[model samples]
Target chain A: MSALDALQATLADEHAALYTYGVLGARTSQSATPALYDALTAAYRRHRSRRDQLRLLVQEAGGQPVAAAAAYELDGRLLRSAQVQAEALELEVAAVERLLALVAQSSGTVREWALTEATWSATWQVELGGAAGTWPGAPELA
Target chain B: MPGRPLSRRTTLGSALAAPLALAACDIDPPPRESESSPATPPPPEDSALVAAVVAALVRAQSVLDAAAAAVPSLADRLGPVRTAHAEHLEVLVGAVPEADLPTAGAVSVPAQILPALGAVRRSEQRLQREVREGCLAAASGDLARVLGSIAASTSQHSAALATEVTS
Candidate 1:
């Protein structure tokens, strides 16, 4: 994909992530599941920060950034800790893939930023009871 | 649900000022042909890049195998890690002719749990560093993507292994 296209995809994933965390974070309480709640809140803020940065990126690149959806689909049954962790893992996996694409298409600090995010995603996976697998992003290659 | 259309055309006037914005956002503009650097050669093909990745995978497999045999108690935790390396090997081998990849010798396992886990963790950390460097050096987009993912995977493994060794 072109650089702009990759950035747009990353922006879209960030939007989805923000929405996902907003849903899941509400269910997690600071008293009941402090770690998970903190993680979710931190992820929400990170996604929002990246989303805003990417919107500026697309605009600077002479492309229109896509808008976020009103709501994302999720089963309310994912109230359990394991279920929420799994959902977070899935979102990170998708984000890593898009970030890897951006890494390929970018250079300088943008590439560095993507690499940092990729590492963070993998670390998060281990925390969520998953291995980074043989491949974190490019499973098709594996 | 569908997203509501949000027109950002209010910023249309900012297009003329995009170059400064791009710089501020760390988005470099496309380089002109005349401004291309002559020092750097283009990215090598997949086969060329596969050698380093394959070497790292082989070393990782050997280390994990030895580590597993040494500390049977940690086998459960190490099992998925070993499998991950094997899968990486499979993918790397497919990138090039079999003859080009190195044949790894079996390394002897350490006698104790901490030592074995430590060895495995060190090997993983080394592999992570090499793979990250390889990813940065890779010119081919596909090769870079694979290397980047491998680097991320190795980082994950190394981090978890560190915890295993300590805890």
Candidate 2:
């Protein structure tokens, strides 16, 4: 994939991530589950910032950024705090995959940015109560 | 579900094709390139980059091993991080020739458990930075992807170690 295409693809994933986190944030009660609420809120904001950055990157690369879908299908019901955290973990894992692709398709400053973002995404997985895998983004190694 | 698109599969397939091929092979010595061979070989610096990362992993593994030995109580916590570095070393060792591989030097652990754990955490953070730099400097996208993944995994290790030290 071209660098621009990779950026757009990552942007699309960020959009879905933001939407999912928004849903999760709504379900989490700050008084009852303060930690989970904060994590979800932090994730939502991070994804939003990433989405905007991708838009600028796409434009600078001489391509029109892909638009976010109106809605995306959630993987599972977010009824419980555990369920909400699990869903957020899933999103971050998926984000790591997308950012790894971006690293693979781009070079120089773009690749550096993707690497930093992928590291943060992987760290977020642990913050969300997931195991730290030997290979965070490269599942083929696993 | 917001399923990943097919393009990601294609991208990863193309990007990882080289390293995955290397990973699948036995640890046989790589065949020397002949004048008649038409295949484009990776730049010399790529090999150097991989070798440097392999050395870093070896050092990190040694540090973890020493820390675990000094503090039996924290072995369970240090086990996964050690395993991760070992696995990373195995994969990267395939990328460089046997002759170019670096040996693991002696590493010492502090007598106190907390200080030993703190030392291990610093080692992981240093390894993480080295791998991240290697990822950024890699010439081949395949190498960059692999290094980037390792960097991410190392960062998680560092974070876990920090949490363990404080908690």
**Alpha carbon lDDT of each predicted model:** 0.69, 0.77
Question: Candidate 1 residues A1-142, lDDT tens each?
Answer: 4677778988988888899888888877789888888888877887888899899878877899999999888855787887888888788888887888787676666676777788788777776667657778765544
Q: Write one digit per residue (lDDT tens) for candidate 1, span B82-133.
A: 8777777666665453436687787886879877877887888888877777
In order, the TM-score of chain B in each prediction is 0.68, 0.74
Candidate 2 per-residue lDDT over residues B37-126, each given as its tens digit? 223444566777877888888888888889888888889998888888887877776555343657788888986888998898788888
Off by over 4 Å in 1: B1-46, B104-109, B162-167
Q: Which ten residues in a row have the lowest lDDT in candidate 2 chain B?
A: B20-29
Interface root mean square deviation of every model, in Å?
A: 9.1, 9.6
What residue pairs clash in candidate 2, if any at all?
none
Q: Give the residue spans of candidate 2 off by over 4 A.
A: B1-38
